[model samples]
Structure formats: C-alpha cells, structure tokens
Target: MSLRIRNLQSFLRPINRRFPQAVWSSRVVTSIRYNSSTPNNNSSRRPNSGEEGSNKKDTKDSDLPATNDEHNELLEKYNPDKSSRVGTPKGAIPAIDHDLASLLKKPKYEYNPENNTNEVTYEFPPPKSPKQLKVEKIREKSKPKSRFKKIAPSLIAAGLASWGIFTYSYLTSKTDPDKDGETGLLRPDKFLPYVISFKHQIDDDHYLIELTRKNRHKKLINNETLFNGKTMWSIEIKQPDINIVRNYTPLPLYVAGTDPVTKEPHLRLVSESEEQGKFIIIVKKYKQGEFSRWITGLNLLHPVEVRGPIVEHKFPGHPLDKFYIKRPQLANLLSKIKPDPEYPEKLPKPENYVYYGAGTGILPLLQLIYSPNPPKGFIEAYLSIHSESNLLDQFKTLNYFAEKIGRVKFHYFIGEKGEHLSSKDILKPTLPNFTGLSDIKLSEEQYREKLLAEKREEVKRQIANGGISNEGKKSITHEEEENHTIPKLDVSKFKPDNAFQQFNIFKKRKTTPDPSFAFVCGPEGYMADVSGKSDLNNLEMVDNGPIGGKLKEKGWTLQNIKRLQ
Candidate 1:
C-alpha cells in the first residue's frame, strides 16, 4: 500500500510543480466543499427545513479531511485559516457569547417602579469642620490668583492716568484766552459761549431754546446757585452785519404738574445735565425787531454768549423809604400820617396782586408767579394780546399753575374790534349822534349800574332755562348755581379800551386787610394808559417799562415804582 501511494505521489508531484497555483486553489475549494457538506449531531437547529438540513450537513462535513495524511500535512502547512480564519464562519461575523457579553457590559441598577416617587431627595455633601474650612481658605490664599486680579494694579494705574490727563486738559483749555476769546460784552474768563443743544417751538413766534456748555467748561456752568432771585440774564448774539443783545428771564428749570394717568402732582421732567449743564430761555420773535429775528434764525449748536444774574429791582420797606431823604417834603407828610398798623415794621407783601402784561412782556411776571414758593397772596393777571389763539395754545401750562395754586385768576384781553364790545359802549346813548357831547368814558356809578343790569338779565335767562322756580320763587342751590356760572377769569376777546375797565373792576374787588399792589408791563402807551393818574383807592402801582418818564410825569417817584426792561 505504501509503495502504491508513493508511486501516485510521484506522478502528482510533477503535475503540482507544473501548475502550483492551480493546485493550491483546488485544495482551498475542496476544503470549503467538504466543510459545507459535512453534518454533525452538535449542529444548532434552524427554522427553515432546507437551510437547516444544509447547515447540519456542512457541520458534519467540516470534521472530515478531504485528502491523505501527506496531502493533509502539506495543506496544513499552507492553510489560509492559520492566519485569516480566526474561528469565524465564511462571510459571517463572529458573535460574542451571551455570558461573556454580560461580563463586558457596564453594570446598571435595575429600576424599581415602587421606588419611583414624586418627592425629590437630594444627596448633599457633609459640612466641613471649622478647622477644615480654615485650612481650605489658607490654601486658596496661597494658590496663584486669576489673571484679572494679577493685572488689577496696572488697570487702576491706567485709569488714574486717564483721569489726570482729562483734568489737565480741562483746566488748560477753559482758561486759555486764545481758545475761548471774549465775544461781545461777555468776558471769556467769566461768561462763556453756550452751544444751542435743542430748540422747541411753543407757539408760532415763541420758542424755548436750550443751551449747553462745552465739555471743558462744564464745571463752571454746573453752579447750583447760578440762577437765584428775581433777576435776568443777558444773551449776546451777532448777526452777519448787526450786533444785537437781549435780556431774558429764564423759566423755572422744573415745574410741578398733575400726572395725566395718576392725577398726582409731580415735578415735571425737565432737560438738564450734571457735568455738562444746560439752561432754557424762551424767545418771542417780532416782525421788525432785529434782536428777535437774530435769535429765531439761530440753528442747532449755534454759540451764544451769556452773562449775569442782572438785578432788575430791589424793594425797600416802604415806597417812601428811598425817597424820605431825597424829598424833604415827604418827612412832614409821613410824620402826620401814622404808619399802617398792619405793616409797622415793613411794607407787607400784597394780599392781592393784580398783574397787567401785554405780549412777551408777561414772561418775567409768569416766572415770579410760578416760583417754587411764591409770595403768599392771590394772583389776578390780566394779559392783553393781539390774538386769543396765542393764549389758547399756552392754556395747558397756565391752567396747570392755576389748578396747582387754586387761587390764580387769568384774564385774557384779545385785541379785535368786532369780536368784543368795549366797556365804554355802555355809556353811549342809543342815538347815533347825540345832541349833547358826552364823555366816552363811563363814570364809576354808571359802570356799577351797568353791572347790575347785566346781573338782572342773567337771572332772567336762568329763570327761563328752569334754573329758578317761578311759582315758589325758589332758585337753584348755591352749588348748582355755581355750576351754571361762567368762569370768573378766562380768555376773552376785548377792545383796547376794555383793559382800563378790567383794571378798575379788579381794584374795586374786596380783599384781605393787607395792602395790594398792581404791576403793569406793556408798550409805552399801554403802560401809561393802564397806570395813568387814576384814583386806585389805596392800591399801589409798579410800572414795568422801557421808559419811566410817562409814570414820573404822573407823580410816580422812582422809589414807588419798579421797572424791568
């Protein structure tokens, strides 16, 4: 048998040598076929009958060798399985055993449904002992700090350097004469130029101009006591070819008004600054006035020179105090007439102040009236204007003050003939041309009679309107009657002659025992006509005028009258 096998091998060796690669490939194919065809009892059962049978046969054939011992040994020497098989199936991935996979997996705590509760329990770390805390603090201190903490000193030094530079620049620039030279009547060292920060139109010809100081001079303008007392500041403006200067009394920087939503009185918001301060000035443009034209034509950031808290007037204890020495004639007259018992030490502030103003001349008076703490008295202001629309536009601000004080009386005199009937008309006879020439002015008696007649007509009208009971002779209650009555003082169209009549009525009205004063501000002729020689019945007059010659002619001494222009 061995000799026969050797002869067969000798015959095959020549064929193997001639086709070495073919022989190796055939051996690999035979091995695969034998492994696929063999069956084994230990093979796993499959669901598909045909596939299960094939897999069983493949398992059984894998145990049997296809060639003799010599061939088997040679094949084993060149077997691809030794390097590549790795115990895996052909084209099939090796799977981990169930027990081995479980050992390799991360351990997990099984969830218990019974332990799932809505209440949450937190595991807090145990508190450290005092000694441990102290040790930790010491360790933290010894450790290196953050980058920001390390460079904090450098940052502070840089900040201080910047502040010093700014201070030096500010002091030098503000004081430098070449940089801020004197303009007009304003001295650069004292009054400086303020740039126009904002402009708001209050009316057709009225504007509220806000002026701000330059950055370098901000500290100078931030003076708390800059605008104090009843004084005015002068503004210097230069036109292309004209030099014009005007004096203005600035309005209060802040005012008190009722909040629209809350109906509570609050300090109305005002535009102001701290380091860079600003002030507002109200200007009224005039048709032919050069100063007004120049002011109105200014643009935003326009520089304006401003100076002073110019003293307009100073009040003495009495009207005759300043004149007592000047006029010797007053000494004898004053000795005979005992000083007023109510005002023995000093002339008391008027219990009732009747103010008369025309157009923009009313500004200073308005400022005084709306002062934070004005004189304790009632105010009756009569303003004469060219149009009623002008007063209507300012009604909100005026009404706010009126409502705040609750004692303010505002009477507007609109200058239009057809819209208003003159008080003098009441004295005229029914006939167009009377036989006897009568005085156009009405006597005091006639004026009182006319008022009585008007009151009777008003009562008759009320009776017709069911405000009074005809049969019972019973009228409406006082409160109900007041509701129907017109406002005592309100905007009204008036003839030029009506101003004198209104002044007379205001003077006649009864007031507290304290003395009263009448202030009149307007055109030369208007001031004269209102404050002219007339029996005021203990009412003193202060004329605000550009020219006091007319008042002086009327026996009004300089001491008795205060003028602002």
Candidate 2:
C-alpha cells in the first residue's frame, strides 16, 4: 500500500493538479493514492473545489522514503539466475571474444574534425567460417567464364575443320610419279581410277565396254583370285557427273577375230595366259537410267572412277575346286559325253542345281558355268527374254558347248518366239520349301533378348549398391541390346517399280524343308513369278527379307531361295 501511494505521488507530481489519492491507488475502485510530508495523512483525500489550487497541500514522491524491499526486487529481476520474470534471458547465447574482430557489429572510431587525418584503426573484412569460405569459392566459379574460355570450343571446332579440309585437298591432289593419280589399289572404301580401253556398241540399247588399270605399271594384286569364284560378283562403276553408281557383272570374253564376212567383232572366252585383270562388262541403258546414260556418254581414253570386284554372293565351293581343273580337263569331260542334239530320254534327269535368269542377268550365270571348275552336278539354265536380242550368238556358243558336255542344258523361253518363261512345266517341278531358317533365327534372337533383360536388371542393381570397386567398369564392355519392339517390314521399299511387271506362279504340295539351291534373277515381274522379291536392309545392302511371294506360298523360306541383286 505504501509503494502504491508513493508511485501515485510520483506520477501525479509530473502533471500539475493532484488527482484524488483514492482514484490513483485503487484501479478496481477507480481511485489513486498519495503520502504526505505531514503526519496529517488525511491529506491524500480529495479537497473541496475551493481548495483545489493550493500548491503547499500537494506531496511529492521524492519526499517519500525508498524501501529495502523494492530495491531488492530490482536486483533480482536483472540477475537472470535469480530473475522472477520468465524468459527475460533464455539459454546463454554465444558471444565473440573481445580480442578478435567480430562481424556481428560495427566498431566505433572517429576523427577530430580539425585534424586532416583519419583516426579509424581496424583491418577490413572480418574472418569468415569454413562453410562461408567454400560457398564464396563456388559462387566465383559459377560466374561466366572469361572471353577466351567462353569461345574455346568454337575456336577448336573451326581449327579442326580447317585442318580436315586442307588435309583432304592436299592428300587427294598431291601427285606421285609412280602412282598415276591413285594412292593405292582399287577398293570399295575409295573410288580409284580406270581408263576406258574398248567399247563395242552391239545395238542402240546394248554396250560392251572394257575398263583397265590407269596405272598399268602398278600391277593389280592377284585379280584372277579376286574375280573368279563360285560367288557371282560385280563391280560398281560410278558416274561422277551425277554421283551415281551401278553394279555390272563382267564377262571373260574378248575380240578373238574380226568377222571376214561383215567386219564385226567375234567374241571368244578363255586363255590361261590371258587371266590377269582383263574382262569386259555388258551394259543395257534403260531410258530413266541416269547412271547408264552418263556412263555410255563418257569420253574414251579418259579416266573414270570405279570400285570393287565387290563379292555380291558367295556360293558354297565344291570339294573338287581345290584341284584347279584347267580348260583341257573341261574339254576332256565334254568329249566323254555322247552328243544328243535333241531332248533325249527325260532330259538327263533334270540337273540338281537350277537357275532362272532374264535379260542380261544371264551374264553372272555364264561367268559361273564357264569358270574352270563349275558347280558339281548338272545345272539346268532357263533363260527368259522379252524380245529378240543379239545375245543369240553367245547363246548359240553356250548351248553348243552345253550339248557337247551334256552336264549343263540351256532352256530358252523367248516371248517373241511364242514361248513364255512362266510355263508351268518349268517352275512347278522345282520351288522347294526353305527349311524355315528365318523363323528359327528369330526364335533364337527373342531368347537372347530375354537373357539380356535379366542382365540389364542385374547391372541396375549393382549400380544402385555402388559396385564400382567390384565390377571395375564391366558395364561399359557389356553389349546393351536395344529393348525395341520388333519392327514391321517396310514392304514399300522392296515393291516392284512402276516399270516392271510382276508374275505370279504358285503351286502347293507337301514338302520337307530342304536346303535351297535355286538362284533366281530377273526384272520385278519375273522375280515376283519365281521366288518372292528380295529387299534392301537399312544400310542399302540386299537383305533377304522374310521370304514371301510365290516361293512363300509354295512353303519356301529364306533358306530355300537366293535372289541375285
């Protein structure tokens, strides 16, 4: 009560007039308090209106004495350990040592204005924590790189491009005295030079042209071994003007003599000494063939680009091929067979190996049969033609030999002669079921994919568990097969062109899957008639697609038929 009276006296003294002490002290009763200097304590009571302005009657709180009780309470509230109030100073906050420069607050230093000198005394940039220092370094790195560093990649790329262009020009244009403008031997990877030697225009559509080495001094590497084989191969002659290429099968024939009757060239093949790198190719120029048009128009005695004795197909070589049967040996075999000009007693039991060729497609077939040691067993050749051709001379020569030898027979189906190649007697007897090799291979591939799936999961598990130390980069070497769905075949890519006709010859019979020995080559129409048409893979190489066509209808698979490109 005395403290409340004292406090009210101190408060009311600041404002002039005294408020009733009862109103000042008791908040609930809406009153205050006061202590007077005189022992007349009734001085705290409200005065009547006439005595209101009397200054002497008022008491000041300064006159009131201080109590030990109030002073003791002040000391306790400030001392955190002994403080009556809650949460005045919670758990102790860390403080900086006085000796070190702290970043928390600014230091005080000033200059005397009269003196033209600074009185400040402190080092700049307070020391940072380890984490702050690391963060600062990262920020510096994240900033954009200097001019040189920013453009370094582009500069490097330009330099490399310039170097490549210069290198290619220098290497290609640089001439060697012995090389004859070529760096090395003929190859598929590079287009090498060859000079056009001789060309014979058999007709407006047919051309028999010859290509020989540009560098005659630099002999080719065993060209005989490269060209002669059971495999029917061709070379790609590139038309540089249009940047196009066409594959042509070369014949082993040459001008033997000029015909005394008409002064035309007489053709003859074979001479052991003439086997180096000399051969001629027969080209038929179709109307829309840019490659053919450009090739035939090429200047004589000038160099043209050519590549490869590209192996188109490799047939299984006969066991006797190792013996090297010479022309004399072939002659002896021909002399042994009794000559029968006509089809005698069931046509020599029909040759096990059969060939169906149309137009110039017969060139490769001729190359195979005319080779020193031909395929074992009789070969039945069925040649199909749409018109009468000058090929008759060569045909007569081949058929004459075929009749003398009797091991091979030539069957011609000339459209002009009222004989069609699609004769049932020709195709129905053959066309075997292709042993389902394609299906079997697909099954094996699917099984391999299942194994690969398991392997991929194992690899993922290892990666999650941090097996780098255990594997030592084994995953990089592991073949990662694509998890792609089996793509549908693009039938349009292999579909016959608008120019070519498609023939359909179908026969069905119960067949045991047999190894296919039949090789068919012709225009789209004829091919459609024989085994189905073949397609090219993504690489543009001939792909024996899932065998479907006449052959497929007759239960033939890829294994049973080989289509020549």
Candidate 3:
C-alpha cells in the first residue's frame, strides 16, 4: 500500500489515547492528498521488501499450521545478540537483479601489503647487514725429539750416497799428480796435441807448404820421426785399447784402417814382407781451413793426435770393408819413386794414383807412378796445379812419366786462358808435342766453338722434346734463354781415344778398370767428371759439396779443382 493511504487509515481507526481525532484525521487527509498529487512511479516503482508479492501467497499456507513457536526457538538460540539477524545471513546486502553472478556476490576487501592474508607473503625483515668472515692463522707445534731420531739414519745414508758418487767421479777424472792435466799417452811436460805438420816456402804472394801432416800417432808407443824429421811412423796393434780413433771418425781417411779391428786404413807396402807400416795424410791449405793450418804447425818427433783413416776412396766392391791406403800403398810408392835416398822403406804402396793436389794431391800420385811399388796395372794420375810456375816442374815430371810409361793418360781443363793449355791442345797433339799446358795454342773461333759446345747435346734434346725449338709448331714457349740457343759440340761430346781398345789390340787387355775403383783427387769438376764416368760402373764416388751449388746453372761445380789450390 501507499505510505499516505496507510497513514490515513491508521489515524481514522486508532485515537483513544491521544484525543484530537479531528486533528489526526485532518493531518492524514492532507498527507494523503499530497502523496496522491505526487507521481507514484517516481518513488515506488518496486517495493523495498523483496518478499512483498511473495508474502501474500504464503498467508494462505499460514492458516494450515503456525510454525512460529519452532521458528522463535531457533531465533532465540541462534540470535542471542539482538543486533544480528540469524534467520537470514547477517550484514548481507540485497543482490541486484542483474546478469553478473560475481557482481551479485559480496565485495571482498582490497588487501593492504602490511596486513597480507597469505602466510608465505611475510618477508623476514631484510637480512641484517652480514658481517665479514675472517681467516684464522694456525700456529705450528714442535715435533717430539723421537721423530727426528728415527729419520736421522736415512738422512745420513742419503748424504753418504751423494758423497760417494761425487768421490767416484772425482777419482775417475782426476789428473795424474806427476803430470798435471795430462791424460792419454804423453806426460804433461811433453804433451803434444794432434797437429798438422808442414814445410813452407814463399811463392808469389802466397805461403805454400811442401808437405802436410806426414805423421800422426795414436799412442806414444815406439813413436819415431824418420827421414830427417820429414816422415813420421808409429805402430798401434792394440785394438781394444785405442777405441777413440775408430769410434770417433769411423770411416777410413783415405781408404780404411781407421778402425782398429778392421785395419782398413793400413795400406800395402813395397817391402816384400807385410811387417812394414806407415800413414800418409794429404791436406790442402784451403781459403780458410783451420784444420789444415793446425796440421802445418806441428813439430817433428813430437806427439800428434791421430784420428781415423776414414777411407774416402774405395776398391771395386764394398766401401765399408776398407783398409788404410796411406800407411802401405802410399808409403811404398813414395819410397820407390822419391829420388831422395833418405826415403823410408817402411811406407806402403799406393794402390791407385791421384794428382790435382794443391800441395799434396800430387804426392801420392808421384810416388805411385815413379815408385817400384807402382800399382799392378794402369793408374789414374790427376794433378791440381793452379799457377803456371807450379805447373812448369810438375808438367815436366808428368811428361817424363807419360812418355816413359806411354800407358798413362791425362785430362786437364784450364779455367783461365793465359799460361795454360786449352782443352783442344791437350786432346790433340800439336807441334813441339806440347808436353804440358804451356805448349797449347788456340784462336778465337776455337775458343768460341769450345764454349758453344758445352751442354749442346742436352740443349738439343730439350729442343727435340718440344721444349725450345721453333720447329713446325706455330707457338714458341721458351722458358729460358738457353732454351732458345742451338746446340753445338763441347768437351762433354769429345770422346778420347779408347785406351781399352788399344790395350786389347796391342797388349793383353784385362777387365776395364771398374769405374768404382777410380781414385779422384782434384778440383770439384774433376771429381764430378770421375763420378759421372764412374756411374757406368755404379761407382760410389765421394764428393763433399751438395749438388747444384752456385755454379749449378753452368752445370759445373765452382769448387772444381782445375788447378791445385
């Protein structure tokens, strides 16, 4: 019902206690008129009580049974506090009639961080600023005396062992009290180091030694410098005692005999008996060879250290199976040939002869050719005579021998034109029968021909192989200037008269000298020639310099011993 209508009805019906019935009715009528005048929809479109319409329906059921007593008891027990409503949930705001279910529910209180509901959300007051941890130093405690006592024996033993080792070393290496600083064979007072000995003379601006390192001894046993101190000879048969020579430089110097057991360095002597023994060492004064100079300074009859006779040259077969060519062959050859009656008889004969010696290359060759101990057959004699002056005497000597034997042949290439025979002159016998280099003569054409002929065959072959020739091909691919040049005959193409053929026709020819048996002692070119020729026999010729040296392009070794040093 409307508020005004309800108020008016209540006023008209109940008025016994307060009097003024007219006044109350008049007030109610007035309020009713005012409410009727106002618009109803504006204030009461819906009832404030949610059960307003539903209450009318429940009134009919209430007449059947009154549950007020049980309901009152529930109210008394659940709602002891009058301010709270127990029948309906207390403090529940009425839900709005809308589509949103969450909005219809009670609004939750926004959380304050200080009063968080989650128990884990509590943060322990930020860790109190941590204190720095400090490292503590430890104090050492003294060990008991018993521990040191136990280890004392071990320490003493160690010290004794170390001392013993030191003492042994000192004793082994200690010098003799009588001859301080002396070890090997000689005493300190007369200690003689291994040195080269030479006799000198002045020629032009150079100082030349007539001989070099004639004597070298292993031990001081029976040492003697014979032939007015020009020759030295010593005997060392005790192999096991002197292992230094062979162990140090195992190979033979000239042949073998460097090794004590091998006895290869020992050579055969002219004497019919085999007891004779000697050693010959040929050393050249190189541009700068310290060993050569040292050898020249040694004194006669004085001790000179002798190393192995490493045999550089070999026989027909195995090279390692060598003997000393110097002591026997070289010595024997020298005794027979050397005009000096003073020459020793103990020396051995030179198996093969070699010249081209700066100073001594000619020594062995001379001895072999002229000596009674000459090789059983023909021998190769090469000489390295640099200057015309040195050649004069040598040439005369060589000529005499060549004519005397008529079996010996020579090959000589001169680097310089003057005072030396050209290759052609030597190859072809000319007027005066020019015995040596001084007799040869040549013209400009001949010189040019000689120069052009060198390596001509190789050049032609290279061209034929589509290397340099302008042949039929349209294109010309020349890698070098030499490729463009034409080939001509040179010394390489020159074939000497076949001495073997002559031997076969005239004298009974033995087997051709095995090229391997060639004895080469000269400049590098001479040695190379021998080596190359010896290739036919598979000879293992010894050469010091590596292939393709500075003169590699010229196809020659600058170290060639055209003339002796």
Candidate 4:
C-alpha cells in the first residue's frame, strides 16, 4: 500500500504497466480531458434546478466517483464567456473560485439581441432557497378541482327557470283571459254549444235540419246588421268528428209540419221571437262531398257547432226599406192574405225586378223574398228545374212561397222538358226595354229623391196624428234621419190604439207590383246566355269581372244588372 509512483510517470507508461501502478493509489481518475470543435453533448441543455441538477453537474465534470481532493490550493479565475455581459464597468472583472467543490458551477452561453453589435455572453443562475424543492412538491399535490363540475348546479337551475316561463305563456295563450264580448249566434274563436232540435229527410240526398242554441229561451245579439234582408248572409257548420267546416245558407223557415197531422202544414217562416236562438239549413249531398254527407247523416237532438253570418252578396240599396219590417210579418196573416187598398199614386212607388236562377243558386234569393220586410220591389223569378219530380219533391218549399210570400212571380224552365233559360226569355219582346242609360240614371236619381220625400211625409204623418209629446220631440229627429222602420219588440212600447192592435193582422199589400233589378245566378254554363263564363272553382267571394255577356249586349250596365254566384 505504500508503493507510490509519480502521477506524470504513470500516465506516460504502457496500459498493462499503468494498471498495476493505479491499483496502489487511493482514488482513480477514469477520464482524460481534451478540446473538440463540437460542443460536448454529455451536458444537459440546462439542468432542472435544485438538488438533482447540482448532483448531475458534479458527476459530469469528472468521470469519477465523488472523493476528497489531495491539495488545499485555491485559485481565483475570470470566466472569459462572462466578458460579453452588458452594463459592467470598463476593465472590471468578477472573480469566481476555481476550486474542486465549485466544478458543479457552469456558465450559461447566450447572445445579446438588444445590442446592434453581435457579441457572446454568459448568464449564471441565481442562487435559490435551499427549501424551494419542498414548495414545488406541495404545489403538485394540492391542485384545484375542475371548474365545470362546480357550475353544474347553476346550469340546472337556469334551465328549470326557462321551462317555467314557457309553460306559463302557453297556458295563458289558450285561456285568452282578456277577450272582449262576442256578438253573434255563433262565436268565431270558439264554438258554442247547440242541439239539433229538428231534422227533416226530404230524400236520400237532401236534408232539412234545424240547430237551436243550448240556452234556447234567451235572445241572440239584438241587432240586424247581418240578418237584414238587404244582404244575403250565411254561416258555417263544423263537423268535429272529421275536423272540417262547411259553409251553409240558413233559411228563416222552420218545419211546422207534424208527422201525424191529417193535412201536413207547409214549412213556415219564424216569428221575430222564434228566430232569436234558432236556424234552419237545406243540405244536398253530392257524390263525394264528405262535409255534406256528415251533416246529412246527423240525428235530431245531436249536437253541432256553428259559426258566422258570413255576408255573401249585398244588393245595391235598401230599396225595400219603406215597405218592410223585420221578417215573419206575414206569419199571422197566413190564413188570409189580401191585396193592399189601392190609392192614387204614392210619392215613392216600388220598382220592377227580374231574376234568373239555376238549381240551388236560388236559395239566397228565396231568403230575401220570404223574409217579411222584403225590398219595396216585385220580383219575377225564372227558375231552372232538373226534372218534374224535383218540383213534386220540393212541394213544401213551393208551398211556403206560394202561400205566404208576396210580389213574386215564378216561371220554371224544366230540364226534363228540354228547356233552358235564355236572354230572350229574360227580356221578352213586349217587356219595357229602355236601351238608353238615361232611363236607368233618371230612375236612380228619382229613387233617392223620392226616399227623402217619403221620410218627410212620414214625419208629417206622425206630427199630424197628434202622437208626439214635448219629451218625444228629440226622438223624432233621429227617426227621420234613419232609412229603415223597425217594429216595436215590447207590447207596452206600441203607441198605436187598442182597436188597431186587435185588427192589425188584417194589413195587406197590392198583389201587382213594380220591378227594377235583374239578378243572374247559377252553374257556369247554365246561365251563359244571361251571364259571362265565370270561374266558380274558387270558393272565395271575390268581385265579379266586367259585365260581358248577353245582358251587356241588351243595354244593361252595372247600374241595372248584376251577375251573382
């Protein structure tokens, strides 16, 4: 163990001879240092700081196990790489201990980018706290929980609040708490309850049905805006079973006939009191008409939904206002109808009228004529019937008019007899034909002026009769301005004497009358001779096109003629 060979001599000897001499030394240096162009990759780019990086650096400087040094000599040296550092005083160099324990220290090579001139530089890591490693390990173990899981409860609460708002809005919309009052026999927004009180089966294809309000005793909206005879109005019957609605024209007539009567009474028009909460309809089911078939198959006392008083066609003016009151005025006079007492010419005489109808197209007109207060004109209705049996089957319908209606003359064109309505038949050779428009214009002006004169006459009569009181003078002014004369609803409201009421049912009018209007309505080709080629395919009630048919050639303008559907 005491055999000591010099260090320089051992390095110069052969490999086999040096091994024997190295075995006698206390420590072995397993590496030899040398310089090369390529940087030594054995060093890490930058060791992770702490005890681990320093340990790695210590072992790297020498390829030997950690050991004590043989010499106590220490040297102060200037690292050349740190000379490129900025802001150092001129010729000022910092000293570093180049001892064996300081071999772990390494300078970081860097280049100064801020300086315009390119230069090499070095940065030494600052000394860290000895307990920095303990702080980092604790941070790794104590990380915060995921933020999404924390917000889950808030998301669910917001979703529930939105759902509650939507549910409230939907329920309120259905209830419609703020709706105003409705004014009709039927409501547009919701269907009112009704019971089928009467159903008459005319044939396999035709039906006469009546619908009465559930609360039958109460009167409907007490107004005549639609039921007035001046315009043709209709309503729709809904079939909830099929989810469909069909438009129907309701007649004022109800079946007064009983099954057991020896002489079945003809269908009769309803009195004003009876018309309040009841209506009748004529339904003719076609081959594939689903809505019609459903209605025709209903039973008496079955419930149905109805809506409207849809205005179909409005005539020119209230020409009959002077002669008519509310409908059913003739119901009391059915037993005995007589002519009006003839007097010298009245101020405003009624006009003459002509009408052409094909099949069911005549229903609207029938409503106008049967209603008690018809226009102050007489109508010559020319109807087209499919066959002779059609008339026999419609006996009750014909009887209603023949027995009660006045001022209407019917002329039939039987299809089975091979007869069709033509323009020539509408205006015969001997009939008054005023070709020039002056006659029609003069008639219209005369009609308007005569209306005013008639109103003044009515006012004079009321005054002359000594029926007005000082308090009633204000009401007289309003009555004179209004065009129509409405009947009194309550018996106490009548100003007429007791004797007049007892004999009031005896009132009548002249059978022979005036005519002015010419109306045409039917199938497209059925009345082509009188009206134009119309497109009835569209169900909407639109304005008819320019009057371009045989009636136009016969000197009829819109002033005197109309083509109705």
Please, what is the TM-score per model?
0.42, 0.47, 0.28, 0.48
By lDDT, the candidates rank as 2, 4, 1, 3
Top lDDT hit: 2
Each prediction's total of clashing residue pairs, residues at least 3 apart in sequence or on different chains, is 7, 12, 55, 11
lDDT of 4 by residue, 1-565 (tens): 1123235324333332423332212222111211111156844455456766775665566433223332211011112344422331333122423662243354545755545355455366445576897788789768875788679889999999999987886677668854222345566456666778887665566667777767555435454323455777777778887888877777776666665753322566664654556667777778799888777777878878777766666655332343334322344343343333222232334456777887666777777765555654557788886865444333434435443445567778889889977657655212332334455566677778888999999889887755677787534455565855786566534443321232243333444443456787777876566766554455674445556666666666556666665
Instruction: Provide the clash count, candidate 1.
Output: 7
**Model 2, runs deviating above 4 Å:** 1-178, 181-186, 217-224, 322-351, 427-516, 539-542, 548-555
- Tens-digit lDDT track of model 3 for 83-117: 53223222322342364344435566886666765
The CA lDDT of each predicted structure is: 0.49, 0.57, 0.35, 0.57
lDDT by residue (1-565, candidate 2, tens digit) is: 5655556444433222222222222222112222223455555676677766564445443333356753453343233443322332323323434643232245555854435456454455357899999999999999989999989999999999999987886786656433455544457666777888777777778887777667644454443433443667778888766777888887665555567886556665544543445567888888998788777877777787778768777865322333334222132133332222222221121125667888888788877765544554456678887666647466466556653443456778888879866545344334322233464455456667878998999989888755666547533332333553588876535533211111111111133222236678888878877776778766868565666555555565565467887
Compose the digit string of candidate 1's lDDT tens values, residues 1-565.
3344346455445445544543443344345444445344443444487677876676565545545875575565454654433332355222435864554465657876447786365366457899999999999999999999999999999999999988887789777864653322233235566677667666688776766655435354434433322333334434435655567765444323445884433322222233224445777788998887787778998877666545454322322232232111101111221111121212222244456677766766665643332433455666777775454333346444442323356666678632322232111111111111131122334666877999999889877766756585656667778778576674235422321233333333354231144455666556655454322344344432332333334344433344345
* Runs with alpha carbons beyond 4 Å of true place in candidate 3: 1-198, 202-283, 286-288, 297-302, 317-374, 380-382, 388-403, 410-519, 524-565
Q: Of models 1 and 3, which has the larger TM-score?
A: 1
Model 3, TM vs. native: 0.28
